[model samples]
Target: MLTPGDGGAGPAVPVGTRGPTVQTLATGEVFAALDASPRGLASADAAARRDRFGPNELPPAGRRGLWQDLVGQFTDLFAVVLLVASAITFLAYGLQKPQDVGTLQLAVAILGVVVLNAAIGFAQEYSAERTAESLQAMVPHTCRVLRDGERRELPARELVPGDVVVLEAGDAVPADCRLVEAHEVSVNNAALTGESDAVGRTGDPVAAGPVLQARNCVFMGTDVVAGAAKAVVFATGAATEFGGIFRLAAAAPRQKTPLQRQVASMARRVAGTALAIGAALFAVRVPAGQSFVETFVFALGVMVALVPEGLPATLSVSLAIGVRRMARRHALVKQLLAVEALGSTTVVCTDKTGTLTQAEMTVVQVWAGGAPHAVSGVGYAPEGDVANPQPVRGLLRAAALCCNARLVPPSDRQGWRVLGDTTEGALLVAAAKAGLDRVTEEAAAPRVAEYPFDSVRKLMSTVHGDTADGYHAYVKGAPQELLARSTSIDWGGERRPLTEELRAAVTAANDELASQGLRVLAAAWRPVSDSRPVQDEVESELTLLGLVGMLDPPRPEVSDAVAACRRARIRIIMVTGDHPLTAEAVARRVGIVSRPAPTVVTGARLDALDDKDLDTLLAAPGELLLCRVSPEHKMRVVTALQRRGEVVAVTGDGANDAPALKHADIGVAMGASGTDVAREAAVIVLLDDSFASIAAAVKLGRSVYQNIRKFLVYVFSSNIG
Candidate 1:
C-alpha cells in the first residue's frame, strides 16, 4: 500500500487497519493511524518507518544459494580439468621451499588465471534483475483528488479506496476506480489489453460487473490520453488486477535462450568427458609406474583446451552485431537472447491497425439512391481519382456539399492533403473527381447544422440546403443503423421504393462485402422540412445507397517477407481481432494462404477446440487463420503454437495485444504510438511499425543464431583437442 502526502520529506499517516506505515527518509517522522486521531498522528515518523521498511529489510529467499551458484560455474568441464591439473602439479613439484618456488609460482599463476576467469563469467551472467524495478518507478508521482471537499494535489501512492480522483489528458491513472463522471474521456488500456485505440468511457455502469471491462474501469497503470474524468477508487495495491498480472510477470523465471540451454548442456558434456579421461589417465599411469602427477597435469591441460574460453566472447559479438542490424531497421532489441528467439519464431501474430494498415483511411465507396461511386487512394494524399463516371457524379456532389469536412493544404507530400475525418475526406475527394469543387459545393449547399456520430445512434448526419429547397441531409455509419432508416433502394442504378425485399437484397450485398473482409459502411439521405427537425426520424424513410469495402492494405513488401519466413521453414499465423473476412483478406494479400487456401477460424470456433484438438489441428500440415480472437484466447493460441514446438513472435501496439505479446516466445511492439507499458513488456520494438522491419529483425536474429552455433562448434572441437 502506498500513501500520498506533501512532497516535503517529513512524515506520512497510514489509514485503516490494513494500511502500511511510512516515514520520511530525511526527517524520520513516523506516522501510524490506528484511527484518524491527533494522538495517532503524534507518533514519531522514525518509529513508523522502523516498523515497516526495517521489518521488510531482508530480501525474499528462494531456490539455490550464493555458494551453490558460485560452485555451479566451476562444475564446467574446463574448470574441473584445471583443478585436477593444479592438484597434480602441486604434488609433482613441492612449492613449500625456496628451490621449488619457481614451480609453485607457475602453478599459482595458472590457478589464479582460471579462477579469475570463472569469477568474471559468473558475475556477468548472474547480475540482479533491475528492469521491473525501473518500470515500477515510472508510476505517476502525483494524483488529483478531492480532500476537504476541494480538489487538491496529493502523492499518488496515498490514494485509498472510495477516494474521488480527478483525471486529465496524459495523466496516468493512480488506482483502479469506477468512473462517476466523464467528459470526452478516453483511456488507453493498451498496456493491459493490447488494443491500439483508446476506449471511450462514461459515467454509466459498465457491463461485466465486479470484473468490469478495463475499457470502462480507469485502471491503475493506465493513462488518460484525452479529456477529463472523475472516478471513485474501488481497489488499490495488490488487490488491483494489474498488480496481480505484474506479480505473475515478475515471478516468471527468465526463460533460458536456446543458445544458453545448448551451452549449459555442452558444459555438462565436457565435464563428464574430462572426468572419464582423467580417471583413465590416472588409473593407467599410476599402475604403469608413470608419475600420477604428470598424468593429472596433462588432464588439466586437456580440460583448459576443451573449455573454449573465447566462445562466450564470440557469441556476445554475434548478438551485438544482430542488435546493431535491427537498430538500423528501427527495431530496438533489449536482451541479446531476443535475437536468438526471433530466429526460431514459427508464428508471427501481428496487430491490425498500424501494423497491417496505414491507420490513415479514406472513403472509398459512396451510395445515394441507386447510385454508387468509388473514391480512390487513402491517407492525406490528393493523388486519387473518383470513378463516378457520368450520372453518379451528381450524387457524389451531393455527398460533398451536404457535409462540413474539408481538406487542409499539405505542408509536405506534394499533391497531397489532409482531411478532417477520413470518411468525410472520401466524400470531398469523390466530389472533386466529379468535377464538383468542394469550395463551390460548400458555398451552394452549406452545412447549416450537424450531428456527430455516437455509439448508440451509429449515424452522423449533416443537414444542408436552404429551407425552400428542402433540408437535404447525408448520413453514413454502421449498416444496421442505416438499414433501419432506409425505406427505398437504388436498384438498376436508379432510386426505387425500399420494401422488405429491397432491404434484404441490400443486406445480402453488405454481407458479401463483409465475407470478403471489407469493413462496410452504409450511406443514405432524406429531404425534410427545417421546421420539424428530428434526426432520429430521418432514418425510417431513407434510400439505401451502396456499400463500400475498406481494407488495411498489406504492405507491398509483406509478400516478400512472408516468402522469406516460408523458405526458412517458419509458419506464419495471422492472428488479429478484426473480422475473419478482413483478417483472411489481408492474409491472402500477403501470400499467407496455404496452397489449398488456409482455413479461417473465428474466435468462437477456436474456443471450441480443446488443447488436444488444437494440437492435432496445428499439426495437420497446413496453414490456419484465426480471426477476431480476444486477448485471453490469443494467449491460448500462442500457448498452443509453442506447445507444438513452434517459436512464436507476437507483434502489436494495442492494450488488447498485451497478453499474447507476453505469452509469445518473442514480443515485438510498435514503438511509435505504442504505449509505454507495451514497450516495457516487449523484447523488441519496431520503431517504424513496418512488417518489413520485422522481417529484417528476423533475418538478423537467424544470423546471430548461426554465429552462436559456429562458436559452439569451435569451442567443442578446441576443447576436445
Candidate 2:
C-alpha cells in the first residue's frame, strides 16, 4: 500500500497495492500503519524489510542474444528463396557430366549477396537499440534518506519501504512515495507523463486517484525541479509505476511496415507463377519423348531460375541510400522498413511543445502600475529590454527575486539554458532585460525564508531581509488568488485602495492576456514585521502589483511545414497535456486549427468515450486537438487512427510516449530532448527536434517509394522480355 510511512517494504506491503487509499490517509495514520516514525525507520527494521523485498530496481527485460538476432536476419522469404536457388545451382553443377566453373561462381555470388544483406541489416538494427542499453540510467543512483534518527546518503536501490527520503531541487525521485512534508515542491513529470509543465506537490491529504496524480506523491524517474520534500518510500523496483509502464512499452509488438507486406505479397505471386510455368513445361516435355527424370530436373531448373535472387539486396541498398539522405536532412531513420512506411503516412499525430513550438518560454507582456508594457526578446539569452523600466520595476524585481531558476550564460559548446522551471526562468529573463540582475538584487535584500507554493494555496511568497522598510515579502501566483489577498493596488505610481473597479480592471487585463495564448501570473508585495512572517499574516494587506504574461511561441518554420502537410493530403492532429484553451490557441497559431470552432477534447472527456464514440469524435473533426492527455490516452488515439486504416506517424518526447511510438506506423521521436525509452521505441529520431524535419522526412520517404517502383518496373520489363 502507498501508506506514507506505514507498512514495511517487506512482503507485508508489496508494490501495486491500493496507493491512492493509503495516500489519502493522514501522515501520522500512515506512519502507524508502516511502523515508522517522523524521524524514520530504525536501521534494524529497514534491514529486515530489505531482506524480504528485492532491491529497489526494476527487473531487467529479457533480450535476444546477439547470435539469435543475427540468425533472424537470414530467415526472411527473400533470403530463403535466394538460399534455395544457390543450393540448387550447386546441385545442378554436381549433376553435370563436367562441372562448370561459372556455375560454381554463380552459386557463390548468390550466397555472398544473402550473407552481405544479413550482416548489414543486423548491424543497422543493433545500432538502433542503443537507447535501450541505457534504460537504467534514467533513475538516480544515490538519494538522501533518514534512518535511526540520523540522515544519510545511500544507493537508491537499497532504499526500502518505510524509509523517509529527502528530495530537493535537481534530484531524480528514486521511488514512488507519499510526501510527509513538502516545501514549495514542484516536480517535472515530463520524463514519465509527457506533461511539459512542472506541477506543485503537497503533503496534505487529497482525493484518491492514480498514484501519479496523488498531490502528495512523487514517482520514480521524475525530477524535483524546485523546492524540497520529505517522503516515505512505498513502492520500488518492478512495483513502481515507471517499471509497470516500461514493461508495457517493451511488450508492445512491432507493426509490420508497408514494404514488408508488399514484399510478402510479391513473394507469394512470384512463387505461384513460377510453379504454374514449371508444371506446364513438365507436362509438355514428358509427353514429347523426353525421359521423365530429365524432364523433371529441367523443369525444376526453370523454376529456380524464375526466383528474383537479387531483389532483397537491391532493396536494402536503395533503402540504405534513403537512410543516409534522411540523416543529412536531420531525420535519423532507425528502421529501414519505416522509410517506405513514412511515405504511406496518412495522419501525423504530433506534440505541441518543442515539436511545433519553441520550448523556451519568453515574457511577451507585463502589466504594472495600470499600464501594459512590452518586453522584447525570444529566449533565455537575457538580452532584451522593458521600455521605461520604472513603473514595472517592482513587478520585474519580484519576478526575479521570488524565483528559483538560474540562467547559464552561453558557453563554447552550448547556448544559454534556463537550468530550472521554464516559467521561473522567463521571469528571471524579464528582470534581466530591465537591467535588474538577479545576482545584484539578491545581494541588496538577501532572501531569508520562503513559503513554497502548494497545490491548495496556488501562491508562493519569499521574505527578503535588510529591506529599508523592515523586511519585504514578494508574492507571485494566479491573478485571482493574489488579487483576493490584496487590500491595495499600486496604480499609476500611487498606492490606491483595491476597489471593485480596480479588481475588475486587473481581471480584464488577465483575460486579455489569456486570449492571446500567454500564461499569466500576477505579482504582489507587502512590508512585513520581520524576515520570517507567517504565510497567513504576510499575504494579507498586500499591494497588488501587476501581471506578467509569457508564451512558448510557435516555431517560425512550422506554418510552412503545416501547409506542406495539408498539400500532401496528410492530417495533422495535436496531442498535448496543455489546457483546451491553451491547446486551441497554439493550434490556431500554427494553422492546425483553421476553422473558428475546432474539435478540442480533454483527457477526462476522452476517458468517458468508448470505441464508437471515439471514432465519431475523430471523424467529426474540422481540426482535432487532444489536450490534457495522459500517456495511455495518446496511445489510444494512435490505436484508434490505425484501426481506421490510417497510416499513423506519431511524434513523442517522453518515456511514456514509448508505447505510442512503438505502435504507430512511423514513430518519430525528438533526439535532442527525448527520453531514452522513447528513442528506443521510435523508428525515426528528429536530431534537431523540429517539426519541419518530419515534413522533410515525409518528402524523402515518398522519393524512396518512387525509387522502389522504378526498380520494380525495370525488373518486371526484363522478366517479360
Best by TM-score: 2
TM-scores of the candidates in the order shown: 0.70, 0.89
Instruction: Give one digit per residue, the lDDT tens place, for model 2 in 1-721.
Output: 3333335432334534446665787888767665678999888888877876667876554568999989988888778777877887787677655567877887888899999888878877677566335432543389999999999999988888778999988688998888989887888887687566788888988988877788788998788877788998877776677776766777787788878888888888787887799899999998899987677667767777677777788778877877888878878777777888998899999887767777788898999877899998887888879988889988889878998878888877457877667789899999989889788889998999998776578888999987466799999989989999999999978999999999999999999999988999998989888877888987888999899999887877888899999999999999887778877887888899989788888999999999999988887748899988877898899989988888999897877777888888889988877766677778888878888888887888898889888988887777655
Model 1 over residues 183-202: C-alpha lDDT tens digits?
Answer: 65676564554343456777
The segments of candidate 1 whose C-alpha lies over 4 angstroms from its true place after superposition are 1-177, 181-202, 205-210, 214-244, 351-353, 359-457, 464-471, 480-512, 540-547, 551-556, 577-582, 594-610, 627-632, 655-663, 711-721
Give all candidates' CA lDDT scores: 0.62, 0.82
Model 2: lDDT equals 0.82
Listed per candidate, the RMSD to the true structure in angstroms reads 9.1, 3.8
Residue 570 in model 2: shift from native, Å? 1.9
